[model samples]
Target chain A: MEIFMKHFIRAVLVLVFLILQSTFCQFIKIWDIMPNLVLAYIISLALTSDDIMYAGGFGFAAGLLWDITWGRVFGVRTLLFMYIAILAYRAGEYVYRKNISVCVIFTLVGAVITESIFFAANFILTHNASFWQSFFRTIVPSAAYTAAFQLVIYNLCLKISKMGKERSSSV
Target chain B: MNFFKSKLFIVLAIVTVIIVAFMILSAAFGFGTGPVSNGLNIITTPVQNGIYGIGKGISSFFEGIGKSGQYKGLYDESQKRVTELEAEVREIDTLKNENDRLRALLDFEEREKDKKLVAAQVAASSPDNWYAEIQLNKGTNSGIRKDNVVYTDNGLVGYVTEVGPTWCKVLTVLDINASVGCVVPRSGDTAVAEGDAELAQNSECSMNYISKDATVIVGDSVETSGLGSIYPAGILIGKISSITPELQGLYNKATIKTSVDFKSLREVVVIVG
Candidate 1:
């Protein structure tokens, strides 16, 4: 029951961030580009949490919800985020996951790769845009913007990760 | 002792196959309004809209405070202008009566009398900037359908792309995938207004495929040609801000400064069929 509660709280947080990503985040756009809040949450959770399956499951659910609510194509973000969670989980093992700088770097790299893949697919299929233009102009700037927010998100997830541990140790 | 044969790798591969299949099915079958989307909409739409309202309220409170002093000065200036506008109103009223009589003689109908409009507030924006789309609070229940034209008091906004039970998504005029048939009213030359990635960054779109010999110029008004069935004719698209020769020199392309301020677009009207 405790484990179920932990996962349930994580799911709720995912939905909250997903909502902010679409609604409140718009008001804070820097030059028409908003930070990827949902991606930052997924990265932070994957880094701080020890359970890979939970990170992957939450990431999948967030991506599926985002696609259904806001994305033009379904399953695109779902696939990308699932792989991103796994990669972040594996990378977190080699480094000190609790370090804020490491968490920020992970978010930066993850956001860049995600945006690049999404833009490339859009360019290849549509042929209506210039790859280099969107890459330098929007994708890079958006990744940096998302990375800047990882500082706050990482701390938040770190607390959640410790919540379960602290209670278990107390018991 | 091989990574390729690991359970993790096998699981990842299976997930990949399943997601790719889902992507293909969604794209081919147009499952935008399928059961999954509908279910999610039912759960999330009200919550999203409520959060948006709260956010807007907080922001407006701060904005109102900041504009209080500015509004005071504007109010004083408006009082002075009101006297001048009162005289102009009397003259305009006389002219309007004369114009009405002339229109009756010519048997002309009002331009906007036929279209029905439904008002909707913007509930949210696209999660990523790759596409310029917004969610409206109204949906199929509000008589919105795919390709229904959206506009503001200022000008044309975009068309509805996907509709749920209580919400719908609109692809704005600045989206790369959006295109509209437009015409330069002064020259009567038809052109296609299309969204460009580079130009959309500046909140602008491109008017392409203008005839080489056409007398199109900057500052000319552009409106829908009514050539497309989606948008009605004479709906204002924007004004041509600049015209430049195409790279191949075969035609000309004009940049349009849309009249609608998409950045602060809080409300819009959907043309209900």
Candidate 2:
């Protein structure tokens, strides 16, 4: 029961943060350029959580939420985020949870994977002859911006997680 | 192990439930219809308007500075062209009336020209992850509906997709989902104009389905075919920039340079029927 409650609270917090990120932060641009904060948050939680299955489930939910809100090809984000969670679990086996650099790397790599998959899906579905054009224009800039923003967001997620742990311990 | 088994099942079940629920809700109400989405759009409109206003101000300031010396000559030339166009319009009006009268005598019902034009400023643009879309200040309360054609003074811009009380979102001509039936004015070859994700460098659209033998040349005008119920006939779309003839027995394609600059769009007119 305690574990379930903890996971539930963490998932709620992540959802609230994502909504705020999408609404308040002008980090995203009209040219399809923006940071992937949700991916960062998912990676952080997935790495730190004792329950990998719950974390992966939450990540899947986050991807679906994004698909609905942003109106992108459904299931693309879900697949990308699930893979990110699995990658985070594997990375956690090697790296220390406290390492900020790992978090940044995870985010950067996740963003690249997410965008590349989206581009590939579009290419396959639309059969656009100019696949490289879409890849360069939409995928590259979006990944760059996501990586840059992840540098900041990863650290913030770390601080927030630390603060939450401290508060729970105090309580 | 039993705890893990039950926990995994529960988590997977919940995740599946959420996904199914979201898909059903989107199918019923369409995506981005939640109260939270509406509130976010409302809150962000002012910020987007400010950003657009600043960009417009900077460009106009530079343009004013650059044209300070040549303003008089440019103004004289523009005035002369306006007079010429007005005279041409008068002659065309006479011919149009004659045609209408002949059709009326043949018992043809005249097409209704009733349209309410609502001018609204762009509130917000599509987020980085999404394709081309613009939020307008007008919505359902303003009589804007889904598929109402939007335009600028220069040419056709897009169509309204979602509407709120005080705002509406436009799916621009440059979105892959949007397809406009267009025709080459010179050659009269009909084609389907689609947004070219490749030509994002120049923010252009492409017209596909032109026959290989079609006599289309660069700089020829393109206009809406009015075949689709979304857009009216005779609205200017763009000019052909380049044409690629059929290869491998496929239809030809042409790149169109749209007149309305999506990067600098401010005010747009929604033609509501």
Candidate 3:
């Protein structure tokens, strides 16, 4: 019961943080650009959580919430996010969670993957083969912005999860 | 092991169910004009307005400071020209009304165009996403329905695909899914104007199905045909920026430069057709 309560509280905190991130933090505009918080949150969950199901589950929920709030195609984010969660979870096995640089690198890679999936899905549906142009124009700038902010978000998530664990142990 | 059997499964099931429910609710009822969206709009509107205001202030401030001597002359000249244009526009409006009255007297069936053009301010843009969408200040309560055509005086902007009470998302002509049936005004040649992936860059769209023998030169204007029922007839669509002949001798592709600037779209007109 205590463990369940701790995880539950952590998940709620994650949601709250994401909501704030999406609403505020409009500072990272290089040529008018912003980092994607949904992608960053998914990566954070995969790295912090030990259980594959927990990571994937939270990632899926985050993606669905994103689609609802932003109003895009229904399952597009869900599918892309699930794949990212799995990959991030696997990648986490080889990295140290305490290392900040690893978090940044993982986030950069995850950002690229997230954008690649979006472009691939768009191309598949619309048959527009101008992927290179879009990659250079939008994707690279977005990725750079996401990487720049990943350190702060990753550290915050880490501290929160650590506090949750400490409280659970004390209880 | 026990945790895996009981706690893990419960958490997973709960999260999955929540996600599924959220998706269904959003798809069915449009996420509603709940506090979330309303709060976002309320918070975002001022920021967008502030940004625009700052931009205007800085530009004007620099202009005023730099041209203290010549500024008054330029301003007076421009103001005079503006007044003259305003008078001309009023005169044109009067003549147009008189012409419509004359046409009515001739037993011509007057087209009952019942569209209320509501002006909306742009709230936000999706820079990361491939889809080029704009958030408008007006929504369902303002008669801004789904598939309603949105435009500026310059040309066709986009159509409303999603609407809330106080907000609507315009799927612009630059979006991948948005395809407008356009015609070359000079040559009368028809083509489908579809958005490419580089839409965010304010780049050109590809006009397909131009006949091989069609005389479509660069700088030719394209306008919506109203055949799709999405846009009204004769709205300026774009101008032909470039032309490329297809492999077969059946058709050619033209890159059309849109008239409306997506980067700086402020106020837009929603044609309630």
- Model 1 segments more than 4 A misplaced: B57-111, B247-249
| Tens digit per residue, CA lDDT, model 1, A86-158 | 8899899999888999988999899999888988776667765677778788888888999999878888888
Candidate 1 vs candidate 2: the TM-score winner is 1
Can you tell me the DockQ of model 1? 0.63
* DockQ of predictions, in order shown: 0.63, 0.14, 0.15
**Which one wins on DockQ?**
1
lDDT per residue as tens, model 1, B1-273: 797998777877898898889888877876567788777766777787887788778878888688545545545778778657656866898899899767753442255457677899988877787778888889888888899999975789999988887888898989888899999889999999998766776778999899998999889999999988788888888888999987677779899999888777788889896
Looking at model 1 chain A, report the run of 10 residues with the lowest lDDT sum.
A121-130
True contacts kept of 1: 0.71
Tens-place lDDT digits, model 3, residues B1-273? 685687655765675576567667656665454566555555554455455445545655876577554445655769888667656866998899899767754432223245567888776555345667767778787888988888876678999876777778888888766799888878888889988756435546778888888899999999997777677678888888989988866788888899887655677888774
| Per-residue lDDT over B114-153 for candidate 2, one digit per residue giving the tens place of the 0 to 100 score | 5567879876665445467777877788888888889865
All candidates' TM-scores?
0.88, 0.71, 0.70
Worst-scoring 10-residue span by lDDT in model 2 chain B? B104-113
Pairs that collide in candidate 3 are none
Retained native contacts per candidate, as fractions?
0.71, 0.11, 0.11
The candidate that wins on lDDT is: 1
How large an RMSD does model 2 have? Answer: 9.8
What CAPRI grade goes to candidate 1?
Answer: medium
